[model samples]
Each structure stands twice: as structure tokens, then as C-alpha cells.
Target: MIHTLSISELTVSRGERLLFQGLDLRIQAGEAVVLTGANGAGKTSLLRTIAGLLRPDAGEVAFHDGDGNPLDERLARGRETHFLGHQDGLKISRTAREELGFQCDWLGHVQCGMDDAVQAFGLAPLLDLEVRRLSAGQRRRLAMGRLVGSPRALWLLDEPMAPLDARWRAVFADQMRRHLDADGLILAAVHDPLPLPARTLDLGGLT
Candidate 1:
């Protein structure tokens, strides 16, 4: 099944400051779009809006099926999308194994391909350690386990590579490519260029 995200005439504001206005974008399956801009340029805001985490001041954000029919808002945001923000969203007290179990459940999977995810992220040895004991990069890997444990149609990532070392970053880049090859959609807010081919959109001109 193919899915597409459409954003039309979108406007967003934070407090008294206006972010972007009259923005439009369309992303189809097997595609990736990278959002780029200086700090406070609303890159994260755009991603959050599309993820249904924030209300847009104007316009519409919707998902369409391969046939061009719109999907229910609930299904679009809940079942089809995965949002990974800067914060790893891990409980410091939980062991990596416990957290991964919870993440797989929360992602609506029955621990499918979980072993593969552990191997892919090199998480076998770290699984017994508490999240607080994990380094920044380790925590990031643990948090990302959901991307493999359970697959979703769309991924919204905010600086996904920021915490990783060069090697893990390369691993994640390969994962993103595989996602695209499997007809998944990605919208990422990134400072550095993504290691794969992706369309770049700069969210400039804040007022």
C-alpha cells in the first residue's frame, strides 16, 4: 500500500512570533524530505504539526491512500506514523530490555523482529543495563529499536543522528535507505545532510 502526506497553505505561530506561512508540501511513499534551517526557523514545529502534536494556525495536513482517498485522522496519526524527537523518551530507571519490551508493545507489535533489531543496533550486551547507565549513543540506539521491531508507514525524525558516533550514524543511514526501498515515507528535521538521497526544504523567513 502506498501512502502520501499532503500539507497545504500551512501556518504556525509560537507565542507572539509567527513561524512559516503559506507553506505546502507533498511526500509520497518511498520518498524522503529533509527540513533544514537555522535555529528557531520552525523546522521542528513543522514536523510536530504534521505528527498531530501541535495544531496548525491555518491549512490542512492529511494523509491519502494510494487511490488518493484521505484516511481517517486517527489512523493517519496513530497507526501509520512514528515520531522520534530529540529526547529519547526512555525512562532512566528502566533496563534497556524492559524499555524495548515496552516500546515494541506501544508500537502495536508482538515483539516481531525484535531479535533482529537488537542485533542490528548492537544492543545485545546493553539490554540488561539501566537506561541511565547507558551513554548518549547507547540510549539513542535503544530508543530507535522500534523502527525495526515494528514497521510504520511514515517516520518523523528530529535530529536522529545527533547522538550517534560515526559508525552508528552509518548504520542508521542504511536503515533509512531500507525504509525508503520498502515504500516508507520520511520527514526529518536535520542540521547536517542526510547520508541518503532526500529532497531538502528550508523553513526560513520567520517573523
Candidate 2:
């Protein structure tokens, strides 16, 4: 089922500093919204708020299915969305294979796609290496494997291309486009421009 994310009259702040107020956005299924702003402009904060990771000082974020029916709060927070933050969210002590294995299971027990994801990301060579032993780019690739291994309706990403080389960056660009083509939603905070078609939301003025 396709899902849409709606944010209305949203107000957010960081500590004593105010971020943005009265912000509103609607992301339909198969669409991508890229957050663009200078550092400390609350780009990351907005993504977190949408993901239900932070309490917005004011405003509401809601999830609705294709039929415009509101989803259960639990379902919205669980299998419906995936959030990829600045941190890779991997265990340094574990092998890359183990990390992907755990993520595949957590993302709905779709472990069968792990190998395919590894191959897609060219991660087969790094599988047996401990995560800590991998380079930053390699770790990022491993982290991104979950996006393919386990599908979700919405993806919230922050600087998803930061650590990648030009080649992999282009590779992931294609992947993002494919995700949108499959009726997936993406909201990403990015510095470099995303290769696919996307609406850009600049928080500069909102601040």
C-alpha cells in the first residue's frame, strides 16, 4: 500500500534557539523531497521530527495510506518507514555480513534479499571483514544495503552520499530513482544535489 506523509503548521526548535515555525509539507508516494539549507538550519531536525524521533515544539505529522486512511501510530513508526542518519548505525565489532543479516531480519525478516543487496552494492568482498575494518565509504555502502534488502514505504536519509566515491554516488543515485519509481517516498537532507527529480525545501527563510 502506498503511504503519504503530511506535516502541518510545524514548529521546531533546538535548545534555546528557534528553528522553524508554521512549516507545512506533503510528500506523496513515489515523490522525493530534498532538504537544502546551510548548517544549523534545522534540516536534520525536520527529518527527525517527521520520523517521530524528536518532539516538535508545535505542529503535527501524520501518515496516511493511498486511500487517505490514517495508519495506526504503531504501524507508521514500525515497518512503514526507514531512517538513515549521519551515523551508519552498525556494530563495529560485527562482520559486515552479520550487520546486514541483523538489519534484514529487523526490517521484516526478509533475509533472502541480503545476498542480492550485497551484490548490488559490490559489498561481497567486504562481507567477512569486521565493520570497524572497513573504510568510511565501505561502511556507508554496507549501511545502505538495508534499504534494498528490506523495502519500506518511506525513507528518511541524511547526507546519504557523503562518504561515497563518484562511482558509488552515481550508483546510489540510480537506486534512489528506482525507489521512487516503485512508489516509495524519500525525504533526504543533502548537501550535494540529488541526481533525480525532487522538490527542494530550503529552510533558510524558515529560520
C-alpha RMSD by candidate, in order: 1.4, 1.5
TM-score for every candidate vs. truth?
0.96, 0.96
Task: Indicate the worst ten consecutive residues by lDDT in candidate 2.
Answer: 107-116
Tens-digit per-residue lDDT, 1-207, candidate 1: 338999999999999888889999999999999999889999889999999999999999989999999999887888888889988889999899999888877877644568867988999999999999999999999988888887888999999999999999999999999999999999999989999999999986444
Write down the TM-score for model 2: 0.96
Model 1 ranges off by over 4 Å: 205-207
Error of 1 at 99 (Å): 0.7
Where model 2 places Cα greater than 4 Å from the true spot, the runs are: 109-111, 205-207
* Per-residue error (Å), model 2, residue 155: 0.6
Model 2 Cα lDDT, one tens digit per residue, 114-204: 8768877999999999999999999999999989888888999999999999999999998899899999999999989899899999988
